[model samples]
Target: MSRRSTRAARPAGAARPAGCPCGLPEPYDACCGRFHAGAAAPTAEALMRSRYSAFVQANAAYLLRTWHPRTRPDRLDLGPGTRWTGLEILAVRDGSAFHTTGTVTFRASFRGGSLHERSRFERVDGAWAYLDGEFPD
Candidate 1:
């Protein structure tokens, strides 16, 4: 089996005592937690941040829900042993509340390494959703 297939889902409802895993200054409940609890993100960037937090928390349901239907994968496997450590938003463009499309460039650091990606988002049915992403060379 591939590494992705070998991955297992973390237990749902795991408690987070610290701030959100997305590197936001606010506590989880005030930040990404609200989004996880059915509250809509106000902007594409906010959705992007919450999605990052979802990955950190192994919240696969939230990830699938926030992904644009056209491009959303059938399954998301957050391959095991990966520990997301930090996030840095490098830039954002046109993902405002009034805009339909936007992009966010960020660096996500993990245990063994880091990845730099420029992600695209779009508003679907008046809610922001992840569309796609490109890795920087």
Candidate 2:
């Protein structure tokens, strides 16, 4: 990713307390840092936003860095006309053994078009991180 994209991605949204903007009652680090940290995300939602940031910032290191070894891709593409607008937390639940999960819904604008998605997250090593999530339109 380009430095411009990386720098642009980090500053678009308000600095959240590592918590779910969806009001899921969790901190960002506790909810999403695990996958961001190379562990497993406790849910699918957390994985989504962090991935979004990864794309916006063109954070190839972070993208490759956080991907699960089983399914990690060789490289990521930060497509043209991508911009982040805001984030919102949706729901959360406890997973098995020091693992928690959450679902987050968010809106973003790219190429002058708006998009929405529900992201998931997971917890690992007593911390949360993004796992993998699907874009549900």
Candidate 3:
């Protein structure tokens, strides 16, 4: 495969921590990469966190495709100075429908500083995807 296709076939393998927030029962590459590479994610929260990681790593294509159409943005400009500190999965439940959602509360740090939010997700066509989120002070 040519360099371009190889890059497209396999998204750059950034230094993902030993395990991923997805809880997909494997490392980020083996787990989420499967989904990022066209396979399916196991649950809503998994897909959401993986998308978060994708953003942190600057994977634009993955971010857009996984975004729900109703709320999907025309473009994803993640910008600069945004560093992900850590992830704490608060809870995941009630994912039995296309609109069924779940929440993942996590602490993220960046140049602007740090904040915590409960990100939301929804499943569509047997694939879980990120929607939007809410931040609480």
TM-score of each prediction: 0.85, 0.48, 0.69
Candidate 2 residue-wise lDDT at 43: 42
* Clash count per candidate: 0, 29, 0
* Candidate 1 C-alpha lDDT tens digits along 18-106: 66777665899999999999999998778988998999989999999999999999999997788998778888888887799998888
Give candidate 1 misplaced runs (Cα > 4 Å): 1-18
Tens-digit lDDT track for model 3 on 14-67? 554365534334677786676778877666656766776776677889999988
For model 3, the stretches where C-alpha displacement exceeds 4 angstroms are 1-26, 96-99
State the lDDT at 130 in candidate 3. 74
State the lDDT of candidate 2 residue by residue for 48-136, as single tens digits.
55666556555678777655554567777766666654444433344334446555555555556766665545554554445565677
Model 2: lowest-lDDT 10 consecutive positions: 1-10
Order by TM-score, highest first: 1, 3, 2
